[model samples]
Target: MLQGKNIHFCISERPIIGEVNIMVAPGELTAIIGPNGAGKSTLFKLLSGDLTCNRGEVSYNGKPLAGFKSNQLAKVRAVMPQHSEVSFPFSSWEIVALGMINDPAAISDRDIQAVMEKLQVWHLRAQAYNMLSGGEKQRVQLARVLVQVWKKQAFPRFILLDEPVSSMDVALQHLVLDFMNELKQRNIGILMVLHDLSLVANYADQVIMMKHGEVMANGHVSEVFTNQNLESLYGYPIHVEKHHEGLGLLVHSLPIHHINQRINKAL
Candidate 1:
């Protein structure tokens, strides 16, 4: 499991994340949702070891994150940031291969090919990553991250993604999430920052709601995704309805009149 205990971060003496606690266990899909500047990305950075926390501890598999060397940590965790840039005109295949550079295992071409196919980007393997469309590039980058953690190890591993599907179409969004589900089934923990509440309602095993750098709520989706909780989190009236198929929750904004009424009452 990946664990953050009493985590706090600050920028120039201004707090960004305060006393946040989170855990991502193997085979679980944990989604972090919040408004803009709500510290979702900052939390991700702390967990991924991209930024050191000002206080508290981040651990993976019972060991402190500070103890692991960069390459050692890469073997157990993969991170896909909100924005990725490829300066050179590297082919998609080459970009994916970069994931294995620090890996000591003798990763084969077949392994790389499988990950690309899983991401639905195998056809673009020969294309230049710099030349692909935004969605295509995102998929390729996802493929790269997947390759990093594709092989299972004796201990648990994790993937941290930040708004990975922001550029994907609806169809591709489902496809990418389906791939993530498959990874979870393989006992790979996933922690993602997403703005899509419906997706959170449908796909996440656990949800963490944040506002102003503090954790407002965290638990199973059914427990924390109540209409009242969401309304308070987003500071707007939101309705939670059952899906017709009865498999997932559907969330929608309240009517404008209802929203205005709620605001007036609050004021």
Candidate 2:
């Protein structure tokens, strides 16, 4: 499991994140959700070892994150940030191949093609990466990260993503997330920062709701996704409805009329 204990970070002596703790258990899809300026991205950077924390520590499988050598770390976790740029004119396949640079023998060319096909980017394998659309580029990048931990390993592994499906259309978003769900069966922990509560509601096995760099709630989806918790987290009136057809929870903001009535009554 990947865990953070009392994680703290600061900017110029001002605290950005404080006393935050989280756990990403193997085979679980854990999501972090919060409004803008809630320090979601900063926390992500801290957990992925991109930025060392001002205080506290992060560990993977009981070992400190700082102790792992670069090569050893690559085998345990893969990270795909919110945005990635390819300065050179590399083909989509070449960009995907970058993930295996640490140990090319770990993944085969055939395995790479299979992952690209799963993401529906196999046809664009020869296309220039910089020339693809935003959503298409996102898929190619995801393919890159997926292949890093695609092969099963003796020890558990993890994939840390930041708003991975932000650019994809609705269908593609589900497709990518569905693929992520499948990865859980391989004993890989998945942690991502997501804004779409609906996606979080349906796809996430565990939820971590953050506000001002503090954890407001963290638990199984059913326990943390209450209307009350969401409203308090976002500072807006929200509603969570259970679908009569047994689909799942449907969440939305309260209607404008309801907001006005509540305000009038308070006054």
Task: Pick the TM-score winner.
Answer: 2
| Candidate 1 accuracy as lDDT | 0.90
* Per-residue lDDT of candidate 2, residues 1-267 (tens digit): 999999999999888897899999999999999999888999999988899898899999988989998789889999999999989999999999998998888899999999999999999999999999999999999999998898889899999999999999999999999999899999999999999999999999999999998998999999999989999999887778888899988988867898899899999
Work out candidate 2's RMSD over C-alphas: 1.7
Q: What is the TM-score of each candidate against the true structure?
A: 0.94, 0.96
Once fitted onto the true fold, the runs of candidate 1 whose alpha carbons sit more than 4 angstroms away are 104-106, 254-267
Residues 99-161, candidate 1, lDDT per residue (tens digit)? 888873747789899888887899998999988988988888888888888786778889999
TM-score of 1: 0.94
Q: Report lDDT per candidate.
A: 0.90, 0.93
Candidate 2, run of 10 with poorest lDDT: 235-244
